[model samples]
Target: MLTKKLNRFNTLRNQILTVFLFVMTVVLLFVGVTTFHVVSTLLKNNAEEQIEQTVTQANGRLEALYKQLDGLTNQITTNMYVQQMLLKEVNGDYLGFRERQNLQQLVNSFQTYSDGIQSFELYTSNYKRVFPLDEIDLVNRLGIHWVKQAEEAKGKMVWIGRDPKSPHFFVVLRQIRLMDRWFSPGGYLLVRINPEYFQFTDFITSKTKKQGYMLVADRDLTPIFSNFVGDSKEILHAQQRTVQQNGEEYIVVKQTSPLTGWVLMIVTPVSALTDGVAILKNTILFSGAIGFLIFFIFSLFLSTMVTQPILKLTKAMQRGKDGELRPSPPISSTVEINELNDTYNALVENINHLIQVVYEKELVRSRAELKALQAQINPHFLFNTLDALYWSLVEKEEEELAQVVLNMSELFRYTVSNSKQDEWVTLYEEIEHIRRYMEIMKLRWGDRLLWNIVIPASCFDIRIPKLLIQPLVENAVLHGIGNKTDLGIVWVTVEDCHESSDIVIKVADDGYGMDEQTKEKVNELLNNKEVSSAKGSGMALVNVNKRLQLYYGEERKLVIHSELGQGTVVLLKIPKSGEE
Candidate 1:
């Protein structure tokens, strides 16, 4: 019972289901783990990239603000009115009233920039006079620190650092140049901008709220503006880095403004970026478990559907061991499984039909063999009886009749003896049989059927099929000499030597030869495969041709040449070694 149970477990269906389940489990587990790792890595990378891009965009905006301030400063310093006024030859002088009014109008035109620019100041070098003289106090007149920085800038714009008196102050300074000479500065222009005018809130979106913050700092690593307060030198200067602060991990990304020499830094918390990944991980785990359960059931169903038909076919084949074929039950599954079922169902019927056909054929073959044996016996008896009659005719002194009986009996004996063995004999034995047949033919036609045998002595011992030459001789007498009115010569010639393995034999007759149609018909009979059982007196050539081919193959067979009123030549090629 235990062995039987184990065998049942080992059946093809059970084994297939087991393997399918095992493979599916392995594949699903692999997919789950790979998917988790890939999605987690993807989410983290996307978060880092988004943070970096935000910082870079904020940096670009800050750079644009700096460019705008620089443009304003350039415009004031390069104004033709201001340039020509500063270039006047006065050693120590004040601008004329009209020049002062023109400069004031230029300053007033820029009043709309009050959002970022606090004020514009112009200091002329010739008189050391400042623009907006009405608003300047006597005590705070020149701003010597800014003036020195503006002198250092020459004709270029420069960012002036915060003034100690005004902590929130940002200034851009530039030297005014003369009309014709670039290096000769006419005066200076200074523009003050409020740092609070920059919108840091633009970099922080609601989706990223509490996830990260940004900072803008100067080249000196001092903060110009910051949403998250920090004084760390690394955060201000580092390009991209990871840092731990207050027991929390953060990713820092930074971008530099080319116009202001300031750095834009983004500080992002690692947990805030990856906090949603934990839920994703749990969801994926649940989905994987559920997927495995579904796959297990699917594999069982698939394996059962695939293997059930095969098992049924196998059982039917096993029952066929006793020479019985049983039809397997039909299965409804894939096309190939159904095909197998149909094939097995038809197998028994085909096998039984074949058996019946083979039995009937064997029965017919047996009867044919019996009739053939009986026929062979009749020929043997006839030959023996004719031999006895030949002796009796010799005793009565009838030499001609006795010679005819002897020749006929000899031909019959040779044919019957060889029919039993289908044996090979020496060319000399075949020649003797042909001579006897020719003698009988000569007696029938007298001298008109003249014959010659010119075979070489060397060829006499060559082995050949028995009675191979007699049929050709009979064909010659009947078709060639028998129908001729004048004296006809039938010549049999053979060429053989020790130097060659092939023996050539030719039979030529000078008699009434065949016409084209007759020649073709005779050739067809010789070439036909069924010539062995061919009927009629013309079968002599066909039988000889068939026997030669059977023994020496098709190449060593009879060839005939005949023509009307010209004579006939039959050529036969035989191997010296006969059929191998």
Candidate 2:
């Protein structure tokens, strides 16, 4: 069941359709989510900004009112006539003319700056007075709480919410200090503030009736004033907080008055500022749905255009597996697909040309192998002739000469046998072959040719590539001993280096050695891995060195040293099996 379901989508068309639908779905989902989030954030930010502006305007007005009242207190305290009235004595029931005039002067001062002031009273340690007096005299003694608060304030103005037993008025009280008089307690000044003068409720009501409401609270969180009639307890204590009431969300913004330490809080509904967010959110969701459908169709079409050529090329490649080198047809709509078709055709043509070239080269190689096979017959015939010569010497009673001929024939056999096999031979067998060559040389130059083989017995059993050492021995004979007129000593040594897992072989010759230039040239040729074009002098050494390097690697190969009239030493370093 799962296989059948998977096979439905396995076709090129279905796979492309699935991919396009998945991508379009993800893109539509992302766009819808991002749009909704942006609308929500912008609405919230805009509401907060509006509420903040309302609180700022309200706080500014309240601050201005408090500043005017504060200035009124300053005016009374600085007036000399008011101070004089406080210092005067009360003589009779009715004040004397100067006393009454001085009292009126104090009342005139209150009238001058008392726009919002309900009444002003001066409380003295020695006397008392009230402006706009009633028929019944009222004692104007400072309240103990006001006196203590004023002292604590150090003569600064103190604002009180309401007068004792009076709910309709607030008061500002201060202890007047005599100017230029040290430690002087002059009198107390009290100004009754009519609550109507504030106009805070009307201002707050005008701004918040449709949206929300506003509240003013004292430092203790008491509801001093507000246009909001709902439960304002939370709003009073809230610090720019959010609250839900009656299933409605509200943002409470608070601003504190620096002058009175009163907080002005504006409570605005979340829906008021974000009125169009619902419309915007619904619009985004609807558009996203439409966009998803459109993108799905467009992506499906695009994928078909992209994959059709690829499917055609794949079919062509499958057909080519039957040994037919066919090229895919070019896609007309796509330049890249056309280029791929061109490249595929070019590759097939090149491969056919390569096949023809390899066939011709193979024919030439077969011919060369045949020629090499025929060349081996000449060496075998030489060997047979040498065997006959050895027996003829033996019959003539020349035993030493017969032995020399026998050794020469043995050397020829070793060379010709190894040429066919081309396999590794024991070091012992290689040294014995070297001995046969030395014997022939001794017969020619008799006691003048002194030679020694000082190879260790343990090293002789190690196998090395055939003909590796024989060519070096030949080089010593031809270049070293053959060039010298006097007696020459040829020495061969093999040392087994167990520590380095190697066998070190040396062939030394005491003959007319080469100069610096010749030594350098011979060394360069020996190290040269490239096949020699000219088989000139020292070609035997170069070929041997190249073989040793090929078999054992360059690190374990020939090292040659030579100097004029000194001697030549050629060392062959052979690593153990697999050590190379």
Candidate 3:
């Protein structure tokens, strides 16, 4: 009986070990297969994405080149010098010798001003070449075709046959307008453009690794210029294949010059553009392979050790999940494993305590600061002053003055309503405040102070630091207009600048503008080391500058421009934030 019992125990242990090994093997296979598929799929998608980005960059470069060439052509044709040369006497003959000489000079000027020109010439209305007789036969022949086309299409420039001087030359012809008739032979301004001028070799070779070639072609599908040397048939076939199969992966930019009926085409291969993407794809694949190998081996060792502690700890975790805080079984293998468990528990406790402490402190501080700010000033003083002004105006029997006092009181109320905090006000609200202040000034100074306010509707919604504009207006009125004997004009304008994403508020006063010495004194006061008290001169401007810096950083600050006896303009450049 004792032997049978021992044998039964051994048999049970062997069966459990066999089951564990089988489960581990299955898990390893699943993990390895899944990781491989996911990583491989990710690498392929990333490669395609990189290829698309390369195509976009290539398109941009091509577009830039096309634009540069188009601009150069347009500048040449429209140049005052070229136009004058076209109008000059050709030789000394009214319509013959002098005309030929002028035409020759114009050809020389075109060649000198522009590079990559294989030839330049001029043709008369009768198919007679007037200049550059070297290509006279070719010009006369091409001129017949263009002259016929020019008759049907009036006033428009036409491109004639392939250039004769350069193997890859393209010609542009414009009918020069004379005083009399539209079709009267005005002579053609012919230019021969080398296709090599537009070939961007650096971009193509660097991107395509010399495997791909770039070529410029005319509307006839004939290659004007090519960077790669090969049989024409092979080159054409490769180009056709690339265009048909992987055209989407390539970049093609076409620009037509309105001045000259010439088309600029730029073509770049996708593979050349995104060579980095291919490299990146390979790097990721290699790294993923190495990582998988390392992980697979490490997983084998880790799996066996993982199960025993996991089972023991999982049982304890299950108890906690059921609402019992039980300690996990101590892992005895490594010191790091034991420390991880301890640290996790300690971190959770510390976090919970810290959250509670922060919540309590915030609530306490909010209440205390609000109380302290509110206790600084009283509302009764402002109310009593307004009431006295109202009574005085009533006694004087001035209804407008009493109304102005009421408006001023309302303005003051809005300003002091949020005294406890610095707030942002809409440009419209600031403008309204300034208008109220201006009204009060108008009542005091009458016709002596003339004010003009120009504000755009778009700038009305932009937010500014509260009370920003009012201080500047106050400074202008008190120190500027009040001290001047001459009648003054105060201009306030608000400009909305969408490009720079800013709103500019400008206030100018044409009264007693500061001299250089006075300006220097004011600047000194603004940047003075003394606290807010010693900087009495232009204190309002200084305060505004400080507040602007504090809220909007150093970039946004008050700018002052003043000329003695001329005017002073204060510009405030504020970023447009829609927040009220």
Best by lDDT: 1
> Once model 1 is optimally superposed onto the true structure by TM-score, how far is the C-alpha of residue 165 displaced, in angstroms?
13
User: Distance (Å) between predicted and true CA of 491, model 3?
Assistant: 99
Best by TM-score: 1
Kindly list the per-residue Cα lDDT of model 2 for residues 1-580, writing each as its tens digit: 9999898779877777887788777877787788778878887786677668778988998888777777778778767776555544322244455665566566556766656677777655333444444332223343567667876776688876777647677777777776645526566677777766675666665764437677877777776666666688866765558888788888888888877898888787788767678888888888988887787778778878878888887787787787776766667768888888788878877776555545543453454356456656887578879988988999999999999999978876676563434457888888999999999989888877888998887776788877678777777887888877788888889888888977788999988788988988887886664555467788878667655655554565678888888888988777655223
lDDT of 3 by residue, 151-193 (tens): 5554345545476444457766665554433224345556677
TM-score of 1: 0.46
Query: Which residue pairs collide, candidate 1?
Result: none
Over 6-109, each residue of candidate 1 has an lDDT whose tens digit, in order, gives 99789777787788878877887798889888988898888878777777777887887777777767776777766766767233466777777777777768
Order the numbered candidates by lDDT, best leading: 1, 2, 3
Candidate 2, which ten residues in sequence have the lowest lDDT sum? Answer: 133-142
Instruction: Provide the global lDDT of candidate 1 against the true structure.
Output: 0.74
The TM-score of predicted model 3 comes to 0.37
Pairwise TM-score winner, candidates 1 and 3:
1
